[model samples]
Target: MRVKKDTSISLFYDMVELMERLRGKDGCPWDKEQNHVTLKPYLVEETYEVIDAIDSGIPDKLKEELADLFLQIIFHCQIAREKKEFDINDVMKLCLDKMMRRHPHVFGDSTASTSEEVVQQWEAIKKQEKGYEERKSAVDGLPKHLPALQKAQKVQKKAAKVGFDWKDINDVIAKVEEEMEEVKEAIAKKETKDMEEEIGDLLFSVVNLSRFLQFDTENILHKTIYKFVDRFKKIEKELASCGKDIEQCSIEELDALWNKVKMNARKNI
Candidate 1:
């Protein structure tokens, strides 16, 4: 599986050629069998790996993950080339055209004094170019597969841009409290369906509150999950030191160990 290096070609072009070879008849069976649909999960997985590397604060890891993500792009382009659909050049050309068209402030006569103005102008241009004019709502552009929290934030932002949001931060806080009360009432009724709906409403209101406070719900939730995992592992370590297993511990014992773990964490902080 050796590729002849061509010094005159750009690195990106070489990579694309390498991908074509991998999908060729003489290449790896696994690579040759993958289509865009079958490779979708790898595309998503590599994207998150890139984000994780960035979060890890490792430049080398980030670079490696980015290359993995780029390989997915090349993989798809090679598949498209095989089917005589389109190729890498067409992909780059369309991307370049899209960027040029979207940035009228830089490429055209349109003037934007601020980032917000630039974003507004870009959205307007995107709507016109992407057939969004036929859509009934501004929030129609978000993908259905987007995470629930991120979807909430995007739709809320779209609506807020058109002044369909709470008047102030206090209003958002009040709405969250109202939702919480409804959730409590639903719990008292003990109906599963009502409880589920109320819980969702409460979560949505909390996402709104986070948005109003200029915090991303998705990111904050990720941080909280990491914290939980770290602290729980510490509790497990303490139990192991005492020759005890977590599953053998009572609820009260676990609660005490959790408190000790939190105390130790605070001390370290």
Candidate 2:
């Protein structure tokens, strides 16, 4: 199913008008009092809800959550317009201009027969646009706020594009084993900082291996975490039925219960 598309630019303006009305005299007390700083958390929350809807594969919920996200955007734009800074129109124009500049194969004589060539051309054009001096690092374009695994994957992909990567998956696997050995040594020595560093290196190498194998490290980790949560909750409910708390349970008992739940889950799957 398709969402009711915001087909006209006027829709954005209308949303802005609504935000202004809500913030006007005798309007919503909560909306009237919110500023960009105050609304930041809601923006982040709405974004995650949109991501959740997409992950759950619910088109109707996705559309609703997306509209909430757009509302946040419009709210922010309305606030900025009041300060004479920028508005939704400026945001739209900037995006349009950036896309036009980035797609040389579409708007210019440049042609790329493959996605890899397109990426290389895009990076080259980006560097030319920024004049190189502004970006001192090859991975500088990556967002710092990205989840750690995704950020690591992005950094590795960027470096690989510039030929600064392992020759094969075997090399990455070897590096991971080396990092694991360091982690084990650090653990044996009870060196907390060293152990942490080595563990991070191991995880980063795993992300690199996932990239080489054409797997999404983020999705893999997310699914694993979800499974752990589900199985743990089942164990919790089972223990509750037995009138035994987790803290009071022996390690062996907990282990047995966990394995039972896991095996049952796998059988169902």
Candidate 3:
């Protein structure tokens, strides 16, 4: 049977029913066996894949990945329904309510003419939400599994909101320099524990500097990684052209090839 690709709302409920059947008593054993805990990894993986699809600038791939992510949400809702907890309807309703409540400028009589004002009002509304009112710190609600670099930025941003931040970008730069010196001191003293600790502090300091400068540490690092891989591939191709294996090249030969590749890359840019 062929499914229509039009904007029919019934198709959404049909997909929900499809998931229900997959977990039904007479359905596939693998689908029946999954629970919230067991599906955590795939949920995280699919979310990342959706992000990757978005970054790739492909609409079709984004659509497909979004469906995969939506499936994870549906799977969780199904598990909750089976346990006599809330289901997808409740989830949607809560999200709808929250959206209406948070955007008072749109849904209520509150006024916010600027994007910055809207953000401030949204945060204020969020703090007043039922469970959030008890948050002792602005950084209290960070997801435990967020990527380290992203999590660091969130923590720094939350703290900065409460005025616990550097007064200037130069101050952040100086802190990064101080952390680097500490790392060097740890290495020179051959203190294994201090080295580990100081290295982490140095990374945190760099993350702070990036956040202060309005740069995303993860995205910047990923771009640098992609660049390094591209340069290395070029070097490999150059060596292969001469019928030579990379392992056969000395450090000097590899460096020369790398420089040549770098020059070519610069010229292309």
Candidate 4:
């Protein structure tokens, strides 16, 4: 609260002004060359960096990553201003108006005492917005650029909202098992495209199961991927101790090491 009370608003404007200067006639050549399209990768990369900082549980790292993400927003706004479109003020005003409009419990007479009720209210209000009226499907607004796992989960969530979902957790589990069987059959056929498509279906079913259990599929997959990498690196380190290459080892040897490392991981837990 002290930080909020003592925060200087001028710092924000200063950063905005710096971005403008960077994109000006005599400013940085690279900055002047960038448009919203060219800076898309940086925006996505900075977003992940912010997520990483949060996962690391480091406040200072999160603050720095957030600033990097904010720079992407400022960069796009500056480019728009140069093209005679809206500026940062318009962006801030629109966001302010959106929050004020969405949270009617605080800004108006509407009442929502719980978080779930607030989300329902927000979605209801969103459907009444001008741009949202044209959406042909409940899942239409999800960004195409989202990771496949996240996109699948979001699509399932939209469908669930309209009661187009499995009525029981057992049904969800059954769907996953059914997909797995199809995947194995596809692999047995030795058809590459069929195998790929079946694997995708299997993954989509797993994402649905994760959603039913109220877990974030993308985050859970990330944890599994990192765990695999950690154990593999340990295997490589063990091989280095014996002055032998993993590639030179027999499958049986590698499997022996793998079981040992897996056992150690469980014991540590």
Model 1 spans with C-alpha error above 4 angstroms: 1-9
Residue 239 lDDT in model 4?
99
Q: What 10-residue stretch in candidate 4 is worst by lDDT? A: 1-10
**How many clashing residue pairs are found in candidate 4?**
0
Q: In the order shown, what is each candidate's alpha-carbon RMSD?
A: 3.7, 2.5, 2.9, 1.4
At residue 259, candidate 2 shows an lDDT of 94
| Model 3 regions lying over 4 Å from their true place | 1-6
Q: What count of clashes does model 3 give?
A: 0
Q: Candidate 3: minimum summed lDDT over ten consecutive residues — where?
A: 1-10
Clashing pairs in 4: none
lDDT of 2 by residue, 193-266 (tens): 99999999889888988999989999898899999999999999999998889999999999999999989998
lDDT, residue 43, model 1? 88
- By TM-score, the best candidate is 4
Model 1 is weakest, by summed lDDT over 10 consecutive residues, at 1-10
Full-model lDDT for every candidate: 0.90, 0.88, 0.92, 0.94
Q: How close is candidate 4 to the true structure, as a TM-score?
A: 0.96
Best by lDDT: 4
What is the lDDT for 198 in model 1? Answer: 95
- Candidate 1 lDDT tens digits, 11-65: 8888988988888879899998889999988988998899899999999999999
lDDT of 3 by residue, 99-185 (tens): 999888899999999998998898888877799967787789988999999999999999998899999888999999999999999
Distance from true location, Cα of 102 in model 2, Å: 1.7
